[model samples]
Target chain A: MAKRDTPMLDELLKGPYPSFVKELYKVQERKPMVQDLLGQLEDSYEERIGHWKHGGIVGVMGYGGGVIGRYSDLQEKYPAVAHFHTMRINQPAAWFYTSDALRTLADIWEKHGSGLTNMHGSTGDIVLLGCKTDDLEPCFADLTAAGFDLGGSGSCMRTPSCCLGKARCEWACYDTMKLCYEFTQEFQDELHRPAFPYKFKFKFSGCPNDCVASIARADMSLIGTWKDEIQVDQAAVADYAKGGMDIVSDVVMNCPSKCIKYNGNGIEIDDHECVHCMHCINAMPKALAPGKERGATILLGSKAPIMEGALLSSVLVPFIDLNDEDEIEDLKELIGNIWDFWDEHGRNRERVGELIQRVGMATFLDGIGLDPEPEMVSAPRDNPYIFFQDEEEEEDDE
Target chain B: MGTPSIPEIAEEMFQMVSESMGKKNLKAGDLTKAIRQKYPEVDRKTCKLALRELMDNGRCVYAYFGGSYIQLPHKEGAAND
Candidate 1:
């Protein structure tokens, strides 16, 4: 009897991109494992025909949430592929890729992939979109041998990434790169395991400008900040003013707490009123700078669209002394506790933010022993009655 | 192009139907409506082909709920309409 042909290959080749199937054709040149991936890919294609053709989910059992690997069949007949599997690679400390490393990665990709890349995914990883399951292990091994590694997916802890801080930026309040590296090493187990309730992302910023958008996209947003007085040099202020610095309109107006004031000769900052949003420092870099006591402000519960639209993470640890190992460990313990608590209690598809919303924030605070503060509230505006002081007694006209 | 097989399209349609249903059953016309939401690139004809394939394979059957029409997969050993 003739082999049962499913016509799967015909339909898949009709897609806008057919390169994944094309890649399988080069089975001779591909690594032996790639052949396995090809076979699995075909099997996956067969299985996906009924579901993916229309639109449905296909995920592994052990993992919580992942893009169900979808494929357009067409491989049994036509061998040429126009697309391949893609992965989102998380960059190192500051993404300072060595020239040699860059060349090697490009070469590896050129050899194996379609070479199209989405420079950065919303969460800040280099997303490479076409590879096979068999290629996964070996590709990771190759990348690792050449000083690269697979980033987190599914329920694993994603790569802890950071922005360029002291290395070249003038506004760096803390050593973001070092801290990112340290966290990467410290949370290796979390980074590799697929046992969490859902995926967790960590992003660090050098200052409040949030180049990496940690506030809007990560579960843990570490933004560089300080509690000490702003370093205001009158001479520098004068120089910046001479160089056409709009101190009043630019810096003072933008200050979150109106902490800055321009008095003809110089800019004055009321330290007690500064919320350290970094607006003044960013606007007048030379005139105003951060204090010597550099640390990080840690926020939690942000994400890119799961339970709801994107959320802006809220401050968890107002200030953490990153210089001390014990302090770092404190943060680790907090993270571990939250992860453990969430892992045991979180629904399969829910994120930490979702869980927090489901269970009252008060309960989460109690579980973690975190003191509830006004800043900890998901929406400060949600409780108008609490913050309403009724205009401070209205002068008590008797 | 070769005529797509019933089972092939059924499997893909089942998933698409499930995603479109999203914890709710929708009418046959609603499948095209929902399909367009997810794959704006594909035309209503392609979606109908998918639906036809699904129905042929017994993955979905029509019924009435809340005084409106809706389509759902025939659950294994389910009572007949």
Candidate 2:
């Protein structure tokens, strides 16, 4: 195939930051489809409109998701990218990968796809950019043979991802990677099938630091936290003081809850008021650590701007012992209850957060068999109006 | 009656969707609920599997009009050509 002119896209190659367009150009000789991709993208840029059309059904047999069908309106002009379907392969726990695994994936993609990829998509899947419908089955077969499977797409549970918690970070309160892997394994059917009212995502962050941005992204966000006091090393604190680290401005004053104070020689944290925000811990990593009674705080209904608007997840269960098997099972049961309620009540394309907004939080909690909790709200309502059901009226009706 | 097989459920789903085309926008959850109501023994997972079979066999397709709906192929907004 001859290289199509892409002057507009070529302009991207001259920037200070390394350009993906430049990378595509580098691989154009071996994989000619990338050149066509660039050409089509440049055409779209020139036209100020997207050339891709959605709503094509494409996937492996018995699976309802994982392959997103794409077709270009400019099919005749750019035949190479006419059917540029994308595949989302589930990434390994915490995105850990061997070079061999990566090479194998690349080899398969090169054989069956446009040799373009997003190392990881926004939902933490290995996004194989472009392929024809004919190649999808064989590509999936090859991937599954190599012990890799497709991630979720459509209105299903998206591939659950986590931060490298106990594996790398000191502040990690729980085994985030383990929980992520467990959820992925447990909900394999959900990942491969489109059954929900809208897409559901699970994200595990080791601590309130939320390295994975679970609070703003996931439908179910599990952030690590502790019920006990913050652990402190006074010797390390004195060392930080000796090194001229400003404990007052950096740690004490910066605490969102104002629970920490610099005591001239060391620092003291007010455990009850700490709020488990991880600010002080982050500031003095060597001197401070998370308490021993570690678990996770479950939050719910976060999403991008779709129906109601962008929303961060609200607190659901303020703290849960994820390490306990029974508690984990309880958590899974809670997830099922949540899905059942949403599937029955939610409209098409409406996210869980929007559904919660539509049906008052109280109703939602009741529907899911959970009692209202103080932690679920940031503050008590200031409004004088309170809708209440009288017990006498309820007894009479019954 | 015994629990409906996957193929049986798929056929039933195709009929329901084909009948509802242009009249009702039936989503996956709707089909699952309908199937469960009809069979009573068939679980949600089996219903999902049946829907997958229908789509895979080209008997039914997804139509995205604001949200995803199941419909016959070649229908308006159907995801199959």
Among all candidates shown, the one with the greatest DockQ: 2
Error of 1 at A352 (Å): 1.1
> What are the per-residue Cα lDDT tens digits for candidate 2 across A1-398?
22677778878877899988877888788876677787888888999999888754556676667888787777777777778889999999899999999999999999999888998999999999999878999999999999999998888889999999999898888999999999999988777767788889999999999999999999989999999989999999999989989889888888877888788877888898777778888888998999999999898888988667788888889899988999999999999999999998998888998888899787888799886555675222122221333554588799
**For candidate 1, lDDT tens digit of each residue in A10-80?**
46656788554554445424444344345445555777632111112222122212222334343333233
lDDT of each: 0.61, 0.83
Query: Between which residue pairs do clashes occur in model 2?
Result: none
Give per-residue CA lDDT, model 2, range B1-81, as digits (tens): 888789999999888888887689788999998988888888877887888888778777665444456767662232223
Per-candidate TM-scores read 0.65, 0.91
In terms of docking quality, model 1 is: incorrect
Superposition TM-score, candidate 1 onto the true structure: 0.65
**Where does candidate 1 chain B have its weakest 10-residue lDDT segment?**
B72-81
Per-model TM-score (chain A alone): 0.76, 0.94
